[model samples]
Structure formats: structure tokens, C-alpha cells
Target: MRKIIIGVMGPGERAREDHVRNAFELGRLIAQEGWVTLTGGRNAGVMEAASLGAKEAGGLTLGILPTRDRNLISVAVDIPIITDMGSARNNINALTSDLIIACGLGTGTASEVALALKANTPVILLTENEEGKRFFKALKPKLVFIAKEPSEAIQMAKEILSP
Candidate 1:
């Protein structure tokens, strides 16, 4: 069977500690389930925290970077794909993953969620922001899911990934 690539999307520099911690535990759970973790290759906020969590659990990580400089890749990223596509890289993040886990809301995270929905990729939202809730309500139920905790999110992802 092919490897499952689980994408994690969330706020970067603007992420809150609670959201970051959620992403961290989510990543750890994903790793423990023997799935690969994917994130935006940035050193701040949820991106950094999730990568660290996955790495600490001995899981593989893939970073889809928006820059050309390899040295700028997140320290926790095991494989870095430099797109230099700026925010357009969000489309790549949505398309490449089998499913996406959104930890928090931000302009970037919102965009990634929309892109994933457009691409028919399933998305699990961990945070219950107004914008996310509104978007979730508007979308089809099969494509969007909301989880109150990391374990719940992991279980949802596993259910969606399973045949």
C-alpha cells in the first residue's frame, strides 16, 4: 500500500499556544499511527510545533516551502519541497495530502481549507473559530469535519483514510 500523507495546516507566526499544542498532539498521534506528516515549512507557530511533535515521535515529515532557500526549511522537516510559489503553495499543500488537518484559523489556514475543499480533499478542523464554523456549515458534510481534541481529530482522519 502507498504511504498516507497527512497535511497539517494552521496559523504560522500568529498561532496561539493552545492551537500550537493541539497541532503538536495531533502530529504526535499521526506519527504514532504510522502516517507521514506534511506541513508548511516555516519555523514559527503551528508549523514548527507540529513538525517537532512528529519528529519527536520518530515520524517522517515533509515540508512544502514557499521559499527557494533550503537552509530556511524547518528543522523538523525531513523532506523539503521548495516551491517558492508564495501563498500559492497552499494549493500544493492541499493537493498533495490525502487529507488535511487544520489546527487554527488565519488567512493562510483559511485559504488552505478552501483549496482543500475545492480539490475534494477531506479536512478536519481542530479549532472552532467563527469563520471556520461558518465555512464548515456551508460545505458538504463529507468533506469537512470538526474535532474538539487531537485524539478525536486523529480518529476522524483514520476513519476517512481507511477503506
Candidate 2:
């Protein structure tokens, strides 16, 4: 089976309690579905929450780190792909995925969403906020999908990947 690489994009800063819990649930759902997870290797917020969930579930968690230094990779990451591409690393990360899941995030996540859009990869935005809705609305039929919650996002991703 071709590994279903699910790109989990989100903010690196400290997240709210709800976002953290959701991230964990999202990661567990991805792992439970037997899909591979890809994310930026960082130690806080959504990245840490998701990676830890996936790892605990015995899922393959691939982390794409911006720095070439191995020590920069997050401890929760199972496989670290270190690159010196800086912000451009988002492009590589999106390219490695079959689907992209955008959690509540800031600038970095926005960049990943844009990269996924450019790549024509299916993106499932798990958000209910006006900003997220408006963002997708502006895209106007580019294959960007919206889901109100993690479960819906997971289901949408599965549907997109189904043969």
C-alpha cells in the first residue's frame, strides 16, 4: 500500500487548551486510520501534541526540520528529514504529503496551506472560524475542503484518498 502521508500543519507557538486537545485527537485519529503523519519538527503547540499522539499510537511520524542539525528535530518525531530550506521547507513538506490538514495556526500554517494549494494537493481545513471560512471561500473551488472538526477532517481525507 502506498503510504498515505497526511501533512499536519499548524502554529509552532504555544496553543490554547482547546487547540492542544484537538491536535492530540487529530493525531490519534490519523494513526488509528493507519495513515502516515508528516509535520514540522518542533517541540511545542500542535506539532508536539500531534507527534506525541501519533507516536503513542504506534504510527509513523515523519518530521521535516528546517535546520540540518539533527538535534533540532523534535523528540516526538520518529523520522526526521533535516533540510536547510528555512521557510521554503513548507513546500517540501506539502509535496511529501498526499493530503494536508490545516489546524488552527498562524503565519507558518498559512504558508503550508498556500504551498499545498500550489501543489494541487487536497487540503482539509479543520476550522469553524470566520477567517478560515473566508480564506477558503476566497480560493473559490480549488480543491480546498473545510471540516468543522478533526473527525470530519479525517473522514474527508479518507474520501479524498479512496481509490
- Best candidate, lDDT: 1
Evaluated at residue 155, the lDDT of candidate 1 is 92
How would you encode candidate 2's per-residue C-alpha lDDT over 1-163 as one tens digit per residue? Answer: 5878888888777566666677778888899999888889877778878898888888889888887877667798988888878888999978998988888757788788878888888888875457765776578466788888888889888888888
Clashing pairs in 1: none
TM-score of each: 0.96, 0.92
Let me know the TM-score candidate 1 reaches against the reference structure.
0.96
Model 1 lDDT tens row, 82-162: 899899999999999999999887889989998999999999888869777676747857799888999998999889988
Error of 2 at 6 (Å): 0.2
Model 1 / residue 89 / CA error / Å: 0.7
